[model samples]
Target chain A: MLRRIFALMLKEFLALLKDKRSRFVLIIPPLVQLMVFGYAATFDLKHVTYAVFNEDKGSISRDMIAAFHGSPSFQEMPQIERNEQIAVMLDRKTVQMIIHVGPRFTADMLSGRPAPIQIMVDGRNSNTALLIVNYAQDIVNRFNNDWVAGNGGAPPAHIVTRAWFNPNLESRWFFLPGIVGLLTLLVTILVTALSVAREREQGTFDQLLVTPLHPAEILIGKALPGFLIGIGEASLIVMVTVFWFKVPLLGSLLTLYTGVLLFLLSAVGIGLMISSLAVTQQQGMLGAFFFMVPAIILSGFATPIRNMPALVQDLTLLNPMRYFLVVLRGVFLEGTPFHLLIPQFWPLAVIGVVTLAIAGWLFRHRLY
Target chain B: MNNAQMRLLGLIRKEFLQIVRDPSSIAIAFLMPVVLLLLFGYGVSLDSEHVPLGLVVEQPDADTASFTASFGNSRYFSSVPFRNTPEAVDAMMAGRINAVIVLRQDFARRLRQTDGAPIQLVVNGVDANTARIVEGYVTGAWGKWLEHTALQQGQTLNTPVEIVNRVWYNEELESRNFLVPGLIAVIMTLIGALLTAMVMAREWERGTMEALMVTPLAMREVILGKLIPYFILGMGGLALSVAMALWLFHVPLRGSVWLLFATSALFLLTALGMGLLISTVARSQFIAGQLAIITTFLPAFLLSGFIFDINSMPPFVQAITHVIAARYYVAILQTIFLVGNEWSVILPNALALVLLATLFLGLTRLKARKRLE
Candidate 1:
């Protein structure tokens, strides 16, 4: 039985390799997707255009506008004449933020009165808009410090902020790690989902059944190659994310690999289950998509899982990608130890075991 | 009475039977987008709140303790106490906290000494956008607290500048407002392309194309027969999805219903034609599905500006997006659903879609096997 399983697995691998197109699909798309999505999926907003309505027309306001120009985050667009232009600029998405210094700015500051400047932000892209708002506030706060110190008064209630885990909070660092999980979902599920359907379509599935292989053996045989391919795809993405994108990987290599291995099992298992239900390649593709989209959206790749409502968060508990994303981020960015990763580790293990077992049972039951 | 019309009707009937028999396809077609919308709307949130934070207080004065208490009480942070900054950093790196707030030594003394003390804020910039928001929450809270403290101390530091964030169309900037509407376009494109590509390719693979060619059917009839059913199916899918978006997800429909349906139909024509083109080029269903997915899926998801902003993409990518049918549809959908049915916004995108659809349909011709041989 063991020898027969190995032979069947080898035959499946050979068949996959023989089809040049399938081989290409298995290998090339993952790399391409990694590169495209890695660069494109960034939430880090750069080159935010800001308009300054410097009513004060003083050195203080000019210096503040200069600070906005100095930062890579903000690009100072042409000055707006009327406040209405701010609305137009925002409407056109030409400027993400606008700063307005009041007309009595120099007089107010010289007379020991509070100097108020108005900052207007277009909140279309809320994440980027928030960034612009924060950066603007920082610049203003710095200006306040300089001005107050120059006037021979002490600044009150100094705030010291320390960002934990990811010091730079580079969106790429958080996103790239999650790419491992995303790529796993895309490749493994898609590849496995199509396997049985392709065989059925080509009339080879009957031939495979005629061989002296048990359905369990066939299930393992079908899943292992995809499992291996998923791992390879994940490793490639990890390399690009860590080295090329310069995302920090602070965790142990062993723990990361273990988590990846477990994650692939659940992904492949889900794919095999999708394959068992699909009668045709079209159904298979659709089935994979049915799983992939929800899995991705709910996995906390694009959004924070914590922000999810209670019911949705509970539903995400069933999604293997969620745990895998947690593991990937924990390992890559946080360098979480094995003990620290137990919550993530156990959920993945449970999902892998349950899904593979169900897949095996389905394979046995479905095959004639 | 033409043989072509009969043959085309027969093909469409056969396709519908296949779809009806395959209960999984129907389930997937209807359920996939509904489930995805619900998941995306409820499960995915770009707005950050209640993020875990670590706080380290160096000197325990009344002012320092009160300041720490203020941070702890804020709705944004679920504050966890740490021994020191290094310990907080370690905890943060261990994924225990989203951020850390450190009260420097002599913080109370500094508050008493001057109103211009320098405060340091360090944020983990792994997710740059989220990190920036985390910084905002911390600073916004701190600033408010500082104002109160200054008022108590009889020192007023007033800023003549205030920022008013006016979010138009979507007042709350709810991601759902954007994502739900975008899902309509994305889902429609996927179904039209994937379904047409498979069904059309299957006919060829089964040698039914040769049989159909022998009949008195015109090429136009054959194409129309295949196109109409999937078009109807695509529209049905769109209706179900839109209902889900409005009723279930609560994404408000601000535009004209007629315009939405009209633009969606036009967009479906382009997507269906693209799929037919793939089916014509690929002889096997497998290859057809692969071609369909590559052409339709990536463009619809990534290049279409559904999730990522196209303007932010590299210039070459932006240029390449002009040819993407989904780009036009996404703009149309966003405009209709979010910005309302303004003629100026709708016209250009509708024109682009119509042009692409005509081009794709015109390019996809019925090929004779005799010619190939």
Candidate 2:
């Protein structure tokens, strides 16, 4: 029985290799997509243009404006006049933020009175706007502390902070790890979903069934090539994310690979199920798409899982992408030990076992 | 009354019969889009909240405990205790927690003194947006605690600066408002492509096209007949999606209904014609489907400016979007739903859709006449 399954698998694999274009598609597109999506998926805001309206023209205002020019995040644009000009610039999105210094700024400080500076930020892209506000606050706080110390006066507030695990909070540290899961979804689903349908379309599926192969033999034979392809695609993406993108990988390679293997099994199972149901290649493609779009959206890749409603979060328990995302991030960024990752790991294993079983049953019953 | 018209009508009747007989296609056509719209609107959100954080306290004093307790009780964080810095860092690196807060042993002593001491909060900055929001929430909570402590000490504490936040258009920042309107454009493209790709291919596969060609029917009549049923189906999808957006998702329809229909019809014509062009070129259902997915689906999803902002993309990507029919449709749909009947926005997008539809329809007609060598 095992020999028969191996023969069937070899035949399917050879057929796939025979089509030069399909083979090129299977290998080349995954790498290309990995590179494209890795670069495109970044949320880090760079080169944010900011404008200053310094009425004081004092050394204090100049020092503050200089801080904005220093950071890589901000590019100081030409100074603007009239408060209304800020609104116009914001509406046109010429500048992301504006710093306004009041006329009495230096005098208030000399007399021991509070000085107020207003920061107006464009909120069109809320995420970027929020970051600009935080960076401005940090600069202002540092300036205040330095001024107080120079004047031989006490600082206003003492903030003692200790940053845990990832002290630097690099953006690449988080996203590169999640790429492993995203690549698995793209390659496994697209490849396997088309496999059976492609065979049926070419009228070769019936020929395989007529041979001395059990339904299980044929199903495993069909699934292994896609499974291997998924692993290869995952590895390529992982390499690009780590080495090329310069994302840190703190966890053990064994843990990451284990999690990825399980994740691919579940993803390939879903694709095979889609293939079994679809009568035509078009239907198969659409079916894969129908499943894929939701999986990606609800997977917590672009957004946080915690933000989802309780019921929706519960629904994600069944989604393999969610667990893989967790596991990928755990192993790649946090260096989470295998024992610590039980919550993420077990869910993926459960999903893989259940989905594979269901796919096997579907394939067996589908051949009418 | 002409034999050609009769033959074209006969083909359309046959297509409709096949569609009705196959329950799967009918179910997929009507049901799938609704499910997708609902899921996209409600299930997918970019907002971040309730992130897990690891907290390490060196002091274990009341003041430190109280500060840590605030984070524990807050809606945004689930605080887990950590033994030391390395363990906490391990948790963060392993993606166990999004952030970690550690209070130094002298936190209470520093607060008692008049001098301001610096507090450090470490965040995983991998997702820059999430990191920013998480940092803001943590600092805001800490700031509130400081204010209360200062008031208790009876010190005339003053906050020198005030920041006012104002959100426009979508004040609540509900993801549904943005996504539901976008779903209409995506679903319309799918229906148009699927319907047209299968129509000519099915006729060829069933060997009925030879009979139709020999009849007195003009090629124009045959194309029109094939398109009419799909046009109705596409319009039906549009109506259902619009109603779902308004009634189900509460996406306000501020634009003119007539304008929406006109623009959507134009967009559908372009999508259907492109699918027809695919069928004409490939002449096989298998290849037609592949061509349809490659041409329609990816471009509609990526280049149409649905999920990603087009202005932020590279110059070449932005230029490529010019030819994608869904790009114009997405803009038109968003404007109609969010900005209302602003003719300035609507007219240009509508005109673009009309131009694209004409181009694709002309191409399909020209391509249909050429036989395989």
Candidate 3:
């Protein structure tokens, strides 16, 4: 039975690897996506187009606008003459922020009075808009401190901000670990979901069932190829991320691979269950996609899980991607020890065992 | 009825029959919308709240206690006290805390001598966006603390400059206000492109395409037959999603629903055409499905300004997003839902949608010729 399952697994590999498109599907997409999404998934605001409406025309206002120009974050657009131009710039999205200096700007500042400078941010993308406002705030705060220090007054509160793990806070470092989990789920689920359904559609399942192989053997045969491909795909993405993308991998390789294999088992098991329930390849594919979309969304890949409603957060415990994301991020970013990651592993293990047992039961039931 | 019209009606009827027989497509068309709507509307949020923090105060004093109390009292942070920086760092590494606030031993003396008391904030920047948000929240908390302390001291240190920050369109700054509207484009893209791509490919995989090709039906009839059902399904999805956004999620529908429907129809045309084009290009089910996902779904999710800011992206990538149909749809959705019928915003995005719809449908019509290659 073992030998027969091995032979069946070999045949599955041959069919998958023999097709050039499948080979490309397994390799090229992950690498291409890694490069494309790596650069695209940035939260770091760089070279934000900004326009200045400095009505003051004082040396101080010019000096303030010069501060924005000196900073790398803002690219000063052509100065807007009227308030309406600021509105037009925002409406056309030509500028993300407009620094509007009122007519009394420098007069009040030199006379020790409160100068109200309006920073009109196009809040279409509120997150970015908020960050741009923060950047502008930092510049203004520096100018205020300079004014105070020159006048021999004490600074308000000194905030010494340091970001641990990712000092520069590069978003690529965060997303790379996540891609390992996401791409693994995508590949493993697609491979396994397409496996049994493909055989049944091609009229090969019956011939294989007529062999001396047990239902358990067929299940193993169907699952091993996807599990192996998932790991292989995961490793390639990991190498690209660690080497090509230069994301630091602080955890031991053994721990990362162990976590990946366990995650793959659960992903493959879910795929097998999807395949067993599907009557055709199309059904299998759609079912896999149906499961995948929600899984990724709820996994906290792009959004924080704690931000979710409590009931939905509870529901995420059942998702393997959710566990794997924590493990991958922990291992890659935090160098979380093997023992520390045991909590994440157990849920995946439980999910794997339950899904595989169910899949096996369904295969036996179908055969009978 | 005319003979041609009768044949087209029969074709559409057959398509619907096929849809009913295959539970997967209908299940996906209907079930996906509800599942995704709930997940996106309720489960997914960019709002950073309830962030865990490790508060390490070395040689704590009354002033330090009062300062740390502000962090504990704030709704944004839940603080866990630690003895020193090492212990807090350990907690941060273990993922027990998102950030660490350290008040040095001389913090009280520095505050007493001058207003220049230094506090160190160490944030675990694994999630860059989360880290940035935490930093902002912590700063706001510190500023509030400073203000309270000044009030107690009877000293109002007036600043030379004050900023009146007004976030336009979204007053309360709810991330959902934008996210839910943007999600409409993603849903329409998935249902229109990814779902329709598979149906045509499944026909080829099942050898039904050959049978249909041998019939007297025109290619236009066959294409329309495939396009019409999914178009209706996509519309149904849009209506259900918009309703969920407005009623369930309580996201305000500020624009005209009829205008939204009209623009959605145009976007759906482009999405459906992209689907038909993929299915025709890749005859096999597996390749077609993969193609649809890589081409439509990923682009819609990533490049379409669904979540990430497109203007923040590199210029080359920004250029790439211009061709993605969902980009235009997302722009239209955001304007209609948030900005409410601003023609300056709506007109350009609408014109782009029209152009993209024409381009995709024209390409699909060309590729979907009757002759089998």
* Chain A vs native chain A, TM-score per candidate: 0.92, 0.91, 0.94
Off by over 4 Å in 2: A1-3, A14-17, A47-173, A198-207, A339-346, B1-11, B60-74, B78-97, B110-118, B126-128, B145-159, B183-228, B269-332, B342-369
| Best of the two (1, 2) by lDDT | 1
Model 1's chain A TM-score stands at: 0.92
Scored by DockQ, the top model is 3
Clashing pairs in 3: none
Better by DockQ, candidate 3 or 1? 3
Tell me the TM-score of each prediction against the true structure. Answer: 0.90, 0.83, 0.95
Give the top-scoring candidate (TM-score): 3
| Local accuracy by lDDT, each model | 0.74, 0.71, 0.82
All candidates' chain B TM-scores are 0.91, 0.87, 0.94
Name the lDDT of candidate 2: 0.71
DockQ of each: 0.45, 0.32, 0.61
Kindly report which residue stretches of model 1 are placed more than 4 angstroms away from their true locations once superposed: A50-62, A76-125, A162-165, A201-203, B1-7, B72-75, B81-94, B110-124, B218-220, B291-299, B320-324, B358-363, B366-373
